[model samples]
Target: MTPPVIETRALAIGHGRQPLGRDIAFSLAAGEVLCLLGPNGSGKTTFFRTLLGLLPVLAGEVRVCGEAVAGWSRAAFARQVGYVPQAHAGVFPFTVAEVVLMGRLARIGRFSAPSRQDRDIAADCLDMLGILPLHDRVYTAISGGERQLVLIARALAQQPALLVMDEPTASLDFGNQIRVLDHIGRLRGQGMAVLMSTHQPEHALRVADRIALFNAGQVIADGPPAAMITPARLASLYGVSESAVSASLSPLLSPERNVLP
Candidate 1:
């Protein structure tokens, strides 16, 4: 069998010598969406930083594209893996197209300007995400939802084998959240592996091929959404009762909105 696009084995994640989570073993295969469901301070950010090579691993290993993450340089790593942070205010004077075009840096010839092909790829990514109309707009001037879409477009422009998104939908309104989730759903069909952290169980159910129940820096459970997102599981994950979970999710878990395949 082919190796997973991203794998963490017996890993410990935190900053410096601090270990927030341990025994963090998981693998994400091509054409799969793995959702990490957890609350704030559950060490989700620490875990992502470790996987992205931003923080050192206190123990064990993290591999990306079947190679050790610590050994890959920034340019090579950017080509194989892309990242979308939770929010972006763009803080730069670049336009939307310019921002997306930055994804091509790792692929572009050193010290050379972006090529026509690079621009084409960026434009295609924007079109794919339905944001082509905003190509000329200043990135920082756009609304929060538009900026979120822009960030996703930039990551897609990298043409990566794996995409790691940190709470991509945290600040979006209802409509925008659905848009982001729909785009994520489409990525698996394109054979791109995705690992994302989300607090919304309903969102995880809608888009994840597998859901890992994370709490107190540990993955308490891992499986398909149907099996992992039950009332009892939700209750356990969120420290609530099964009846309350069922009551809150009644509409989402209804006959018409069922996400099980």
Candidate 2:
């Protein structure tokens, strides 16, 4: 069997003397998209942080691209894993291209300028997200959707083997959400592994090759979307009525609506 791109063995994630969830064991293969579904404050962020080595693993192991994450050098890990955090307050007025170019910092030495090739990669990423025209616009001045695309582009510029995103499309319009998710789907097709956390099950059912339902601090269910997204599993995860989950997600399973809102 081919080794997985990412693997977590009995991982226990938490913060400040509190364990948010149970032990987790899973592996994500190349060209796969794994969507994490959970209610707010269900330790999704903690899990993401743990995977990125931002938070210490209380127990167990995390391996990325066949090496223990804790054992890898910071620069080497950064090149292998690209992370896109939730929207943040931007104080700098840098242009969109400038913001995206920052992802290349690890590849370039301090105080060294970006080469033409670096600029080209950034521009290509912008074009991939259909935001090439916004390259010259100030990052702070652009709309939320545009900012989201720029952040994604920045992550792509890292040329990572795995992309991890926290709520990549939490506050976007319907059209923009589809656009962003579609772009993510394309990346998986091109052989990049993606793991993203989202509250919207409909979105997960549409774009995710696999779904992992997290509750209380651990993944209660993990499988292909068709197996894990049933009404029974979703209801238990969200503590909602089964009928409601069925009703809200039925449309998502339709072929016509799978790619759009």
Candidate 3:
């Protein structure tokens, strides 16, 4: 059987001498979307950075494609893992196509220019995100939501086996949020593994094959959405009352009345 695209065993993360999360464990396989749900400041971003080897692990190990992540060179890792971080403006006013084309850097030679094939892949990625028209727009001039989509397109251009996205829908409007989630589902069907952090439980229910609840610096629960997204679980994770959770979720997710009256 093929090994998981990413795996963590007894992992610990932190900054310098401080610790954020420990004993972290999970594995994401090909064709799966694993959603991380947590409150703000819950260390989800820290965990992602550790997995990508941006920060040193305090303990344990992170493995990608059956090899230790710490052992892989930066270029080798980029060839395997694509990252979509929170959207922000670039220092320079690069065109959207130029920004997406940067993803091809890992595959290109040190001194060579981007090839026709690379440009084609970047354009295809932009088209995939329904943002082909933004190709000529200035990255710094677009709206935040548009920038977010452009970042996703850039990551897709990498054509990596695994994608690690931090709050992919953060700046998106509702329609675009759904579009991104639906595209995530499609990516799974195409045999890519995705590890994304989101604050929206409803989004996880829609797209994730498994949900991991991060709270107080640990994975409090990891399971199927049906089993993990109950009123009690969400309430505890967010420090809200269970009754409130039920009241808010029932009208949307309840079997009898999924539509609001």
Best by TM-score: 3
RMSD values, in order shown: 1.6, 1.9, 1.8
Model 2 stretches with alpha carbons more than 4 Å out: 254-261
Q: For residues 48-148, what per-residue lDDT tens digits would candidate 2 score against the true structure?
A: 99999999898999998787888887778888899989885478999999999988887875589999999999999999888999999999999877788
Q: Cα lDDT of model 1 overall? A: 0.89
Cα error, candidate 1, residue 81 (Å)? 0.4
TM-scores for all candidates: the values are 0.95, 0.93, 0.96
Stronger candidate by TM-score (1 vs 3): 3
lDDT of 3 at 170: 89
Error of 1 at 16 (Å): 2.1
lDDT values of the candidates? 0.89, 0.88, 0.91
CA lDDT, candidate 1, residue 28: 95
| Candidate 1 local lDDT, 93-119, one digit each (tens) | 899999999988988856989989999
State the weakest 10-residue window (summed lDDT) of model 1.
252-261
- Each candidate structure's count of clashing pairs: 0, 1, 0
Candidate 1, pairs of clashing residues: none
Clash pairs, candidate 3, are none
Model number with the top lDDT: 3
TM-score of 1: 0.95
Query: For model 2, where is the 10-residue window of minimal lDDT?
Result: 252-261
| Candidate 1 vs 2: which has more lDDT | 1
